[model samples]
Target chain A: MSAEAERDAPAGVDGAAPADPWRRGRWPVVTILSVLLVATVAVSFAVGVTAYPPGTIVEVLLAHLTGRPSTVARVDDVTIWLVRMPRIVAAVLVGGALAAAGAAYQALFRNPMVSPDLLGASGGAGVGAALGILLSWGSAGVQLSAFALGLAAVLVTYTVGTLVGRGTESTLTLVLTGIVVSSLCSALISLTKYVADPDDKLPQITFWLLGGLETVTVRGLLPLLVPVLVGLVPLMVLRWRLNVLAFGDEEAASLGVNPRVVKAFVIVGATLMTAASVSAAGMVGWVGLVVPHAARMLVGPDARRAVPVSALLGAIFLLVVDDLVRTVLTTEVPLGILTALVGAPFFLFLLARGRRAWT
Target chain B: MGSIRVRIALATAGAVTAVLVAGCGQAPGSAPEAPESSSAATRVVTDVTGAQVTVPATITRIADAWPAHNEVVQMLGAGDAITATVLIEKTAPWLYVVDPALREAQTVFTNSTANTERLAQARPDVLFTDKSTQIAAKTTELGIPTVQLGFQNYPDLKKMVSTTADVLGPAAQQQAVAYNAYLDDTLGQVRGRTASLPADRRPSVLHVYSLNPLVVDGTGSIIDEWITAAGGRNAAQVTGNVRPVSAEQVAQWNPDVVILASSAFVAADTGAQTLDKLRADPFWSQLPAVRDNRAVINPTGGWHWDRYGIESALQLRWAGKTLHPELFGDVDMLAETRSFYDRFLHHPLTEAEARTMLAAQDPQ
Candidate 1:
């Protein structure tokens, strides 16, 4: 590591760091986004399994919400409330959680590419889901096992990470531990997959590995949503502290921020969000990795602007991808495949042209 | 920074709008109106997924996403129409001789994913598959009509044959009707002979699908259906199509009849002990089925009876004959099997060939 360069001492002691990069237009963007998120979700309910008209979907959803009896066709009501509604809700929750957590990790690790799964939540959840399939436990068991183990994997990583370092190297050490744990979980998943029955169990395992929101149900979403909200609330509250955390620990403390305590809270929040997202919808990669980059590109490096926008952007991106998935073919393509296909090109484009937004 | 951020957001908005338009442009357009009658040159069959898919009323050229469905189509007498197939040579090499026309059919798929472009070049009137979402999607994208074949049980297999026969048009209808009648007659013979047996008199059968992990066929599986038809209760009490249990659990089940139904490759790759390979192991001789000399290998022709294939109806006979040899003592299985090939499959088997086809013992 290079020694710290001598810097010009603050001339006025508090000159606000040269007006901070083009004054992020956060709320205007967010307020517009909040409306977009609602509209996108409302639109998603009309177009899955079978397409219903928008007016009919709106009527059915409103009726279901108000406890007013639905007069729409049985298929329309069932499609909207029973299947598509829960699925879109899952997409929103998972998408929002991944983006929010991704922003947190990018801030905490001070690495732009740090995804929510940097801590091995996806890997652990995969192994758990595979084990559930092997045991012939039903879908509930699979989701529960995945959720439980995903949280466990990260907690173990965090606990193990703190052991290897006391102060200066803690954050980097934690990332290293996460990579190691994720690799371990991935290897275990491979082992389980190897022994699984190729005819039946293997296909189920392969499907889960590919990751999707196609299997989301109302029952499955309830348990996942609570933890995801709980995880996200803390991150949204601590998002401002992310800017302080971005300056290495010594600098953070000098500026009256306890880096370790704040880092722990942020990691826990991110972990919870990631674990919940993964447990709800298997291993959907790239959303956490790339959505934040796009968000950061749009709103500079300030966590207060970027994190919430990341959440909104992630939700919109997933909704559109989900739309493409349901409509593109007769069957649901794994969202992971679509995201990677979409994310990689967008990433290169961001690198090529959006470098200024990162400042 | 401000200007670039606006461009980034605008670019994103533009891309999203482009995708939405392109995506909506392909919204299944309008589902093809299914023809009213089979005589209308296109017959609409509601597939297992409950989607009404139109198939050619006169199926002259066919292709399947997987070779497993090739055997089913062949049995339904539509094998002549197959212009392309997947892995038929390596998998069921017998198909090349049985249906010499298969030699000319292109290999359009080997594993799960089909080469959609090559498949389209094959110019099949209809695509046959045993139901796959990926295949279904690809066929729809390529505007190829597809028929999804499914067999829930022995009874469902009959229905599948009849349905496929109807789809294949008039020429195959005779074979479908004849096969259905044969199915009824064969099962009727088994039921007539075994219907009088008390519940306790019927043997407890265990279908060992794999031996290392000790995976067994449970309820909802085709093996379970065959066992039930053959007049034995499945010993492994479980739910789902199949379940992987322990050797310890196998011992506890104390199955009177253990039928092995795994291949050498599966056994080797999974490091699972096949019934044939377990002769030297200490645990092999300890089981109740082994003690009674009731351990037997499942018969395979084209493919195993357990898999959804044409040989499944014959599997019923084999299961019944093996379980209760006393009742079916007069039925010459070898001669009857040869006749089945000669009459239904249109390929007569010599004595040596029939014996090879009937062989269940591990050559290993």
Candidate 2:
């Protein structure tokens, strides 16, 4: 860690301050995040099928990987391998990706209000998902189109923001464009709902909007995991650049960081992560906005420390919420509803504590 | 600083006071005096959205907004109380079977909310509805009490009969008991009729409609229970209630009896042509049920997802008998329909009207 710090930190640039308690370091954060990632994955697989136990989950997973069939009950096998296992994996990856993206957005725009959802990805994804239902697209096709449409929405937001005057898009301008784009997408979704068959199509669209992992198969999870990893890995590598960002753009530029290039990279990477997650999970809200704030309260506002913590916290938060849905109720509550119900009140409490933190 | 503390104290006190005031309504008051024993009149209670109401020991005037509820009201010997009802033509074409005189007495309500005021002017003692709907809520909030009843399942139907009877007084209790007995007997008959058939011989059924890609009944649903009782298998037992199954999966399952219920599709063309298209499809035609010509078309009238009363039970019997004529015996279902109308509907039907009603069902 010291060797890497000496390589990266300029000589005489280290100024230890009374206000900043500890110097931000990269290796420590990476070590913590790696530990958290493993723990979350383990927890995800551990949560389902109490009868079989966690050891049995490891064994079942190994057996499946090795092509050795077991005499397990088909329901147990299906629930563990087909249903619960994929969903658990999906939740962990998606949650981590969304959290990382949210942190990146906050740093890039130099505003905590900026998150992946600020670009209308979720809304556009919703419209695409509705269209899939309307056209009677198969499950695989539906998921694919949803992801594509989400990326398309962000692309439009980026293009519109950059095109107006300057090459760099201001935070306010990006937000306003997102709102407009989101409204247009929402209107299209409503139009689809208006003409949809009331019995079958309406329920499908409603359930999709509510956002649960019930329908996610291994096939759906695999393609989504690829983009999430691609987006997430780069964000983690460059996560140190985000800490300098909290010093404001002018200060960061003075510190020998190229603010424009860094901001663009982080924004695009974060948007990609959010789009991929939204497409697969179907508009799970509150995770991006609330998770980082939660991490800040837990570990304080150093991005080097906060980002990894937020990602871990986000993964744990979703995993527990998903478990509650599976066990707490006879009917599965939508993940979107569960997140909002829990997160919204907590957000209000945070706002009460320090309203300035919201901006 | 003292003022700030005082203000905070006041706010806390105000919240506490508000909570205490709200909590004060928890205690119950004393019961009202019981009515006279010698009156021989039935006491009817109503819950409607609006229109002033008066509870009486006997129902002198009734306003039936929902036609399915009107059938039960008629069956409970409260036909005289019914001053008006909505959807008479669509609900009980068989109403003429019981009392031909009810057809011409009065046209009390239309399908619009404007009719609420008109019905209020006519002055009804009770309003009847089948289950609570948005319209029922509006009418009840407007001070009109409705006796909501529907038979979507046996429990809901039993509750409807019992609740309606409780408010309809002594005469209704007798009718309720009789109706309950009739339902038991019919269910028993169905069980007995299907007992001898082999499990494999039981027909696999599918309910198709335009509203969804694929819709099927839940295993525990009344539709599944009735289908099983009739020696027919519901294809949806594998999935849960009205779930969206892929079209390819439906083709693979290939149910023996395809029952289409969407009014939207029914209005498209002759029901026969629609059935023919399904039959002609290579995947659909490959099913064993389709080759045997076992597709049965359900008639229009009292076709609802939630209403499972005596009328709905009869409809199930009609489907069973039509699908399995050899097992149920060669009975005229129209005659059965006529008797159901006569017993439960306030209006009498002519033979011509009965034919017209049945003909409207669209195998044509």
Candidate 3:
């Protein structure tokens, strides 16, 4: 396919001609998104409750990078390094991981509407976090429990799917089982909230379910880095196979890829990434489902291009949204609410336009 | 295929059994009809919600649903009348330590919703709940006289105490007067000392309700009321109770004094550990309060003293002394706490027990 023709090709048509996987326009889209992400991060650094001028922000960054003591006010230095920097990094990591996992799942399932939480990772994480808050285990315990339960939820879904649909449609069984498990997890979360002390733990769980990056710190982000990177590297490396798996099971098997094995790998990678993101930032929605569609609209249906583009777009989108959350009002607005507010309308607009990203 | 079918059946059976076992804890049944009220004398008392509730002349068996108001009932010398309570032993250890009978009281409510069957089973003549019209109406339908009470300021607290006393009887009414006098005396004393202090001299106090989410009690909250009464300005510019703000926002506020609630970090420990953790954080360490060691945990008694509990009298004195030690140098919190417990709670606290309470620790 010619580069000019690929630019005009409907998104559904890009999936038909999979031979010309690498379009010439992919680099420019990636480059623009990369530039936008970098600019968003820089701008987020300067935006916070504590106003730091551009010069002061740069000085703090330089001092930290060079392993030298900062001469600016200690409060400003701490605010920039300890509070804002960690929050900015968390927003990027969570947003990128969620969007990348989302793209992988969408390609694996051959459904444009698939989100990272479609398999019940977020619901399970929410239950874990609620239990931690009810037990007064503090922030570390909440994050740990959320990560563990998220993985457990997906595992249960997979096990049930395999056991019940031995010779039937595998993906359909998995999706049905996922819906069952997600609702179960949600009910468990509600039960935890109901039993929590209304004066204390109830508000904590309520706020956590709404999702925010307010509590994220440098030390808190350290433990999550390993899982996020572990999950992202494999998805990026196996993007071409994910694209091939987008075809039906028979076609994918004929194309020299074991459909079931590839799908399993994609599920594991997507689950890890989604769980880590949910554990770090509580129950942030819409980015996973919406960002991948935007990415496909920009770079067509090839996972090799769409996954990376989705990561960049997700990071930029969440970074900007988190900046607004902290700076818009004196009190921090929940991150999940803002993402849905922004994502839902944009999604409706996309649907209204009839982009043919999916049949 | 046959073996898989068996496994699925077994799993389905297991799930159903688990759910059935959970449901067995609370039997599915409507509450038994409450007995008709005795032809005894009745008096009308208006609650905080402006509803005039006709309470029985003598309320012996009481179901106190509001956890904080349980302390108020105890303070009014009606501790024995409480037949059912929502005060968990873990949440309010001091209350249970003082009145062991509270441990035996049936818990008819979890969080805010009352189980009507359980409430009727408790057989309380009067049900004390917060300002939830739904709960009040539900209990009223069962023929239980539900008194809705809540407070957001010192005046409202005094009104709640008076209304609670109205339901208890004449003897408790005297205790209410005494308690209200003590509150006014303490408030007047604190205000008399700190009233003349200039704005610059008054410290900007940040009441840290929780550290992980960094929630602070802002203006329009009872904590804000006490902060002002104790001669400190609320550092949080927002207006609400337990509003979560960013750490950077707190750093910007740069409060002169950071008061940690007893349950700030965890449910169990005194907030000293939470204070230590805050001082260790790079963000908090840079704050003026942490650097100067001005951060202190608010002492919790029957309830958090800084909250809307009856201990606001003690909180006023404590805050005044903490904020302006020079002005209130002669005050001894241990002696005041001992006297308060003896006079109000009817529990003669030893010196060590008083110290533990002042330190915001559970009684051993």
Candidate 4:
């Protein structure tokens, strides 16, 4: 772990002892992750329930993108461009959002174990989605309800924590309130499930709760793209500041940064990304928690490098998982199950190999 | 906890002794002078959960706790005997046509959950329900006997009808026989015509039961039974009674016909979403069934055709006609609906009413 970090630490070491490996940052790692992510997404197109010839799929893709008429059948063209495109795009968007949020959260909270829903967003969104399904709101309506409710839940927790805290101790209060709100959201979800109609509503809630990217449509993606981009752009803009804030409030203050405001901005950005992703594709577990930590191992703890790397890794990882889910199983296996099955082992591997990275 | 356990044991012993004493003097159909005397000629019978319950021998009144179970009981000519039931008007409009007086029957359930206080107040001789620990605990703690039953397919329906007849006694016995006979006759008639046909010749049928999650009735579902009987191949080979399936699966199967059994709720309210929405989805629209407009809505009577109930025969006949029109050419589905209601429930239906009951329409 130390060998790579030391080797990757370029010029300006500024000490007789050495440089802090955590600041051994960016460029090279980002370039590699970018190449890998694009390759993984392109490969995902060939895998599905219906088999398509890879040669034909590539030709159709080139023709469609370049605005040239394809000899490919209309059905195959529609399947590749219309059907697979929305799902593939959704996978990238949801995966990237969750991982970025998770990275921002791990940085802001100074805890690697913390997930994207360091606040109550995912749990709260679950309650919203369940209620929407119970109300027969249809697919798009449920997504909107989930997005609205998730943001509302976090705002409530943030408000309560700020209103009731002793100055800088609000961070402590916010974490505690997030825990309380998450528990409350879970209870409300259970209540909603219990009250739901047995035949139609109950199964929808149960299946939806397990999570999938099966229903991602182009129309649904338009509204979702706004909130997700709105969330992500700020995180990208504030990446260097996020790195500064990671060194503790006193250190951040010494470096001419307001710890409270930076923390707030990061939290809002991360929470928005999380709520948007969860609303789009039910509660997909592990991507947010694990991806950032893996990215940190490669690029050091600089948010500038780690956050984008996490987004790329998360997008590629989820595309692979979703591909395996739809193709490998006879019935569409729930996305949550595959992530944990695959993530837990990889996380254990990361823990062993990157133990020094954390310390 | 100790006191509660002792009280339960004591109550059970007392009830057992009381039932033994009264049951010795009673026969199956002889009514007690008072229905709620606690020892009103109790007869011991084992419920589906394997719990022995001491119900009154002449059960003039019963609380049909699970409304789906009402189909079996109603078909057993015990519709008038159900003193308490779940919501009837919406879930089972057929029950109203069969027995108008049941409109005033005590609503025993709050949605699917039993209102135990209201149920106790109503004082039915036995409670007809599916086996659950809560209900079993309640029945044991209180001295009310409960019978558990479920209907999954036509064969299971016949068994439930027979069991309901046994529970309801001799007067309802004929209806159980009629139900068994009707089920056999319907399937038999469909099979006799369909049996000789080669597998390749049969239409491949897709039975979509839910829309939001896009679930299909796979193998072991009642819809599968109807499809095979109706001389059609079941498109979905997935296991389990009902399973959430992908659009790709339906597209891959590419059934000759698509039959949707949605909530009359979705059909009536989401007019925009009626199979048309499915037909609009890029993946779903590509399905051969959707593309050719070979989709038809399942005619819901009593409960949905996919939902376990008494209307299997009607659903089967409907599927048969849809799948094999030439073979079932003489079969008038609307006329069959009228005849089934008239013969079984003894309720004459107008042609408009029959059409309304079936809710079957070819895709626009």
Candidate 5:
């Protein structure tokens, strides 16, 4: 439309500027992301497998990966295989999914507070999980019910938000819808608690909502891995388009990106990853909201690099926290409590340092 | 951002306070002093939770949702004061015998929310419930005088019974003395009969609940006390009152005698079908108890095992018979049941009632 715009245009029909290729200065961001990712993984393994030492961890992992028989004891094998491994894998998947979802939500709403759980997914998952326990359905059935209910909650949020608009809802409307849906779900959860057998069922319901990977097994890990991979991979791969869309809907459309389509893909992909992770590990909190910010601060706001970096950091963050919970106290600390305790303080420190950048 | 900082600070302070309070709130020093007898004018005054109302002179009516307190009230001769019971355990047989009029008291709701409403409606002068069994803060706030009765283990039962006896006054006090005598006598009989057996010959017993997989009563349970008292070895030595065990773990323990209470066994009709299912299962059949034909199923008693009172003692006696029937070979359990009923239960159980209450034959 302007003379400068015409001059900068890609030499064709009406002089619209072609989309820029991945930013030329992204290499530094990429390097920083790799460093953070590796560091987080290193820290995760360092905290959890403390009994075996770092060298032993490497040897054990190498042996397992290479089809060589492990020298670990049978009891340790059960502990690592049935308990810790599934938990660590689940943490990585959940953390990555949640952080990526948070990033997508923030981009969609153009607000800092938006996270995957903001859409009532966690509350719905908790209620469904509580119901599953009350019904005395064994382990697998409980996880399945939680995931189904989480997806249903997301679907409800999306539908209600859409009804408030012509085709697509704005970030504010979407958030409002999520709050209402979550409140409704929470009320139902309370009602369930009221009727539940106090001696057994209520305790189970409370424990599920508190969130833990205490009983996660390798068999449980298999089903969640598929959806997490499917959901997280494509979103990270398409980060370039995601970055453009973050510039605001009108600007993104003027630049030839279909804002509606991108939003849908990101939401669905992120929701699937979140639902899968929750079904396996319950409603672990804070990593999604905090990890993306940490990633952004470490490597600037380039989605291509930030997505993977956030995923790695999230996995690493949760693993270390979980290990702390198991080893630090005689009783396992609830994952949600630890996350808030650790994440909230770290976030505040980050905000203090990056006050100018944030503004 | 500032709000987040505030939340973090507040949560940190609150969590620290909670941990500190939890730590400090142990030991008898932290608990309120027990209410003194009205008959004694020199009774020491103490801080009371809202539910602990200091009556001017007399306590006419009382309601107890916690059946553990029933023996205490009965022992104090305050049967007339009890207007309602939260739930009844017919398996004890003695509760009916001790006070036939107790059966006529109104039933209070068991589910928590309704229980609260029922407490208000009952409006008794005093309410007895255990800290574990009821919401103390809310109940106290509802303007009812509440007392905490301990039931952490079997010994706690004697303490609760004695405490309630003191509060209930005279007539119920006589019942308490008789009940205690009965307990000592019954326990004495079992102990005397089995004392001659060598330690090596002592039956190792395993109690299983098919309803909740791997749940077995352990150290704090009356079963543990009964087994030890009856000269049998408890198989659940390393576990807690309610333990999570895998089917593999149960088989590996290979208890000398396997027993299932009616409460623990799934409420299915076909005994042969149940036995066959157990025998056919790869995991369950490997148990030595199963192979030796030592597994027995106690008849259904409803939610009777939920409390540890005289009912618990009776169940223990029944468990002792099931575990080592040969120790008392000439002891006719049917005749023993009726006699025990007449002496402890006070009410005569009809032949039909007696048959239905203890009819689950040995599954092995």
Candidate 6:
């Protein structure tokens, strides 16, 4: 901790007030993270249960890029392009979406502990997926139901909050209503699990709850892209307003930014991203709660910088975890378990260090 | 008017006391009669869970909590004694087709947990459930004799059926002997053909339990036992039941045969739809099994044949025939199914019904 403080002291040592290094070194940090992300993605392509030589991977990529047939066997090409690539892309999208949503949510609520599922998206999506499995609705039906129900849950919470609170401390009322809706969604999920057939549907529901990226296909990846982009674009555009809203609601209102409008946009964008990620990956935890904190620790509490940096860190974290999940054993380890296993300990370390990323 | 009402109440209370005395007298009179009844004759038998339970020698009422064991009881000719059951026509359709009386049985359990009040109302002389310590202890506390039956392989299945028969009576005991003999004979026949095959001759087989999450039955499971008995190696290298694996891992294993378990749901054509979806996937389409059209759905009967059920007897033959048609060319599956169901289940199937069962479709 002292070492980090000393390293960061240079910007303030020359007769100036203690200054945040992020404002000055933002480009360098962003550049290094971007390069690391690209390198991780490239290395992930080469790692799998089915080993392919570096040359063969390059040749396969070149063939796909130039619209030429690969000299490698069709099986190898299919394994690379169809099976592994879809999973990798899904990991990046899901991780990035969850973390960006988390950043937006924490900024909106002015709470460091908040995650993207501050409302009821994950809980609602879980219930929908469990019901779909119990009813034998297939994979696509499950994904669609999950996404719709997730959005519906947030909408219900927002509606209840507005109706009850009117205009008096709506944020607090929203948080209260969100907890209520989240628990209701959890009970519904449990009901679905209870009625599911012990032989078949129970195991499927259990596995789906554990969460993984093994089921992602090229066709399925396309629908996920729409909601994630729709959610992320708005959050990135409204990042500065998120910082403004960090100062209490009355202060933001005096500063000419309508706190209510910014908060609504933030909720909608975060809910959309959270729902889309959960629908695709099935309740992947910790990425949303932990990655934004890591990003803020790296680049200070500026949403404009933290949001994108959190997206990159999350993408890298999940991609590496997924790579380990697939390659470490013949069987697939649930992605949520690995993320928690890595995130929880790292979070405790951060807490022990007592670095206040949030005031 | 108040004095008259008090007199009437006093008279009623005196009559109620007189009737209560008579009821007490009848209780002692009926106490001796209870020992003279059939329930007085009790015998002890050990279940698969190794709990020795005292049961009525001539059991008349039973509560069957294990869905798969419903078929076993029906096959043992004790379907009429099942007063309570966990499964209905929707969950186990074939059981209903075999014994319609089961439709009228009390559904005293849900999600494998029994409602004790309903189960008590059913007045079951004995309770049968899977090997769950909780259920056994709960039912035992209710004074209902609990028999826990479960199996992982063929021998354990035989023990389960035999224990179930022991709880049933002498008639079912005789039937158990016949059923066990039939299983032995089938295994002997299948193993006689498959045992001589060299390692290179046996193809690697993958048993997919579900396709949505790509869960497959790995080694050390009932699926693996049958795959081995039918002269094939399990493609899943891991050791667990119903393991989730990646498509890339499947491609790496590149099994020669892919067997999809029939959907437990009642909806028709789910297996075929899953097969089509697998065919559409570029990763699955290129596998040796898919390329050569060797990927097939496992036949289901009273329960999924590949699972831990009595139909595993049929699965032994079907898997053998599917894998090594050359060696088992003379074996006619329709005749085998017809005879087996006739002798064991006591429900003779027509050629069309047998074909439907073999195709893993619902009885039409």
Interface RMS deviation of candidate 3: 24.5
DockQ of each: 0.05, 0.01, 0.02, 0.01, 0.02, 0.01
| Residue range B1-364, candidate 2, lDDT tens digits | 3223323432342343233223222221011111332244444443322223344566677777555566677788886567766645434544533544457434544332213333433456567764323234334433345565544467667766877777677888887887887777777887788878997888787755442445555465566767777778887645334555676767677777877653324345555665677678676677676667766455544334222345665656665675588877765667766665565554444556555444434211
Report interface Cα RMSD per prediction.
Answer: 13.0, 26.8, 24.5, 32.4, 21.9, 34.9
lDDT by residue for model 4 over B128-168, one digit each (tens)?
87543333344333335777666556777787777778777
TM-score of each: 0.59, 0.50, 0.52, 0.51, 0.49, 0.52
- Residue clash pairs of candidate 3: none
Candidate 6 TM-score restricted to chain A: 0.92
lDDT for A315 (candidate 6): 79
How high is the lDDT of residue A81 in model 6? Answer: 55
Ranking by TM-score: 1, 6, 3, 4, 2, 5
Q: Flag clash pairs in model 4.
A: none
Off by over 4 Å in 6: A1-22, A167-169, B1-364
lDDT, candidate 2, at A73: 46
4 or 6, which is superior by TM-score? 6
Using TM-score as the measure, which candidate wins? 1
Model 5, residue B101: distance off in Å is: 44
Residues A290-359 of candidate 2: C-alpha lDDT, one tens digit per residue:
8887655444566665666666667666766776665553235678899899879977776665443333
Runs of candidate 3 exceeding 4 Å displacement: A1-27, A167-169, B1-308, B311-364
The segments of candidate 1 whose C-alpha lies over 4 angstroms from its true place after superposition are: A1-104, A108-114, A118-205, A211-245, A248-359, B1-13, B16-23, B26-40, B84-88, B100-123, B133-138, B264-276, B360-364
lDDT of 4 by residue, A60-107 (tens): 555644445567654455455545655677787788889988998888
Model 2 TM-score relative to the real fold: 0.50
TM-score of candidate 4 relative to the true fold: 0.51
DockQ of 5: 0.02
In candidate 4, position B339 carries an lDDT of: 88
Clashes of 2: 32
Please give, for residues A114-181, the per-residue lDDT of candidate 1 as tens digits: 89988888888888888987886756777788888888898888888887766354777888999999
Model 6, A1-359: lDDT tens per residue?
22243225323322231266335332344555555666676778787756777787776555554445556764455455545665677787888889989988988888888889889999889988888777767477888889999999999999988888975647889988999999999899888776554454675677667787766645566677668867876787788898888878889999999988888887888888899899888889999998897777666778877887788678778888888876764335678889999889978866664355665
Look at candidate 1 and give me any clashing residue pairs.
none
lDDT of 1 at B331: 76
